[model samples]
Target: MYRRSFALVAALAAVLVLVPAALAARVHVRVEGKTQTIFGSTEPTLNVKANALDALDAASLAGEFYYHVAPTAFGPYVDQIGRYPALPGSPNGWVFKVNGIVPPVGADQVTVKDGDTVLWYWATFTGAAGPLTLEVETSIVRGKRCFFATGRNDAGRASRVRGVVFTLNSRRVGSRSGVLCTRLGRYAVRVAKAGAIRSRTYSGR
Candidate 1:
């Protein structure tokens, strides 16, 4: 009876250990460097432990890129991603935001929910607010995916951004809304402009 009880207790402990991992959040992660979209502009889906740092780690794994975290007085700070690190007294440092807003704390201290989008980018802060972020809105019409683009500043004000270039399967497509699944299936769509961070990679079925 004693042995059986010990085995049961061990099994319960095992189950408990696995629960948190199973409760891991499913998120979309995007990393943008100074010149181009570093990662997740092609594949953005990942399941990770709940935090912005975990989301970044998952992106590093999926994209096979590199990142570095440094300890700070507040908490662990991600000072580098890919080939870029935070420059001293320079605006070209790294910053992260969940769903278009930078949290009031460190990346390791922020909790990320399921379906959240985590963006890590090289920031070139010219003012209090950061750079312009881009996003795409898509709709289905007659089995075609119609894509519309927009840009928002750190102030949360958003507007339609025209002259958006659509890249379907890594090829520049002419029209935005005329692509259908018959032309491409189970693929990614990324839009870009001149001086804005690229939009999240929209996947089509």
Candidate 2:
């Protein structure tokens, strides 16, 4: 009976060790529409076991990017991301969202779970016109995928754009034809159009 009890205890201990490893958070991190690092000459999707800041650190970009956090009554407030600083009197700065909804706390304080997605974007507000926006549309034409990217200035007017580019899975795809993704694997579409300073990534099904 004692041997059986010992065996059961060992089994329980094994489960206790395995459970947390199985439940460790797996998150996807993207910066400016590209994978964070190139591992062995191939861009691998970043999956972290901790929060967003931990994921950024795993990518070796924790100190490479510029940012500031202020000690606030609530918590640390992220003031800047990259070169975009939150203006003192403007509603422009770095805006971040997890799975499409803006969090009420800073990125460091937001705990992520498995299969979570973190997106960080820069919002530019200049001179009261409005914030510049870019939109990308994908379609299937002649059984081929195509992408149309448009950009609008602060005034909300479509302008003749340049530097509009597209990439799929971290590989640049031709502008005339959208990425011909023909597999069952995950794919990411990144678009940078007009004079926009940053690019955005759209996950594809």
Candidate 3:
């Protein structure tokens, strides 16, 4: 009887251990217009266990935040903004370094938790090509998928080309034809044509 009781106790202990292990916490992340629901925690310290960093890193790369991550450790956090090596000789340019409550520009030191929003705004600039702007709005919505949209326009010398632009979010799973797909997480709007500004939504439900 003692042996049987011991066996039962051991079984119960095993179950107790397995139950919690199986019920791991999940962190859902959405990108562009597509929903990526994942199960895990995003604590930096606990990264060894589930490694939410990898998931976030993948999302960041696939989404609009790709530009925010610096080429080096201590470099242009928000390169898309006005003054960067990318935009040589650009005048009358500005970046939302500190807009609203969020710091538009951040270093690699910044830790993007599970529930965080990253917005990238491209304002007008003064140059020969004019203000070639590519704005992307990104955020993790309901921990389901990363949502984003991109709009491009030109101003100043290129003011005549101030109008609609469109790009595809191929990161979305099983996407076909840049249009008509849930894969439409974000857009890559560029001045499709010059002349007039025509606003349009290039995605679906």
Candidate 4:
């Protein structure tokens, strides 16, 4: 009886020691203000965190990305998946990849983590309802650092304006900075390391 009791205690101690270490190996991402774990045999995935409400309010903020309302060859860029209206109706909606390689809109539902990269862009609105705009900030899973871009109705609406910006610390790299700007409807930013980007964008007005 004594020998059997000792063996049971030893087995319980072994389990307690192993369980914590196993839990530490897992990782999670913050989406819509909720934390979720990533389960897979993969090392890297398109992992990013977003505060969807703030993203939609990016317009009307000055010095960011603003445009004028004018009906011409350029008004608003249409999305592929949702086909959401690109003007005053749903201005604070959708984030896309403008890196020329992959252009996807509406990243609110998409999940990304450390070592992941995202490119964001928007279009100008020109109609009887005036102009609309949008912005999106990207962050890594574990690091919690952030980088983002804002759109505006510049050029009075004949052209669509956009830009790309990012941070190095949030990317898990170091203190690094850069900026990618364009008025022709495209931009690019490089993901160098965990929290560093090829460029960054700052607004103070």
Instruction: Kindly state the number of residue pairs that clash in model 3.
Output: 17
Candidate 4 regions off by >4 Å? 1-94, 98-105, 124-205
Measured by TM-score, how close is model 3 to the native structure?
Answer: 0.26
C-alpha lDDT score of every prediction, in listed order: 0.78, 0.55, 0.32, 0.30
* lDDT accuracy of residue 44 in candidate 4: 19
TM-score of 4: 0.20
Using lDDT as the measure, what is the rank order of every candidate, best first? Answer: 1, 2, 3, 4
Model 1, runs deviating above 4 Å: 1-13, 140-145, 173-188
User: How well does each candidate superpose onto the true structure, as a TM-score?
Assistant: 0.75, 0.50, 0.26, 0.20
Alpha-carbon deviation at 125 in model 4, angstroms: 9.4
User: lDDT tens digits, residues 106-172, model 1?
Assistant: 8888898888888888878778878778776677666765676777777557877777677767787
* TM-score of structure candidate 2: 0.50
How many Å off is the CA of 54 in candidate 2? 3.7
Model 3 poorest ten-residue lDDT run: 33-42
lDDT, candidate 4, 109-200, per-residue tens: 34333334333333222443323222333444344334444332322122222332233323332323322222232223322221111222
* Model 1 weakest lDDT span, ten residues long: 175-184
- Model 3 over residues 1-205: C-alpha lDDT tens digits? 9999999999999999887445433333322211111211111111111332333444454443443334645553334322222354545322321111223234333344433332223334444433232232334445433323332332212122222333343332211221222232445321222222212223332
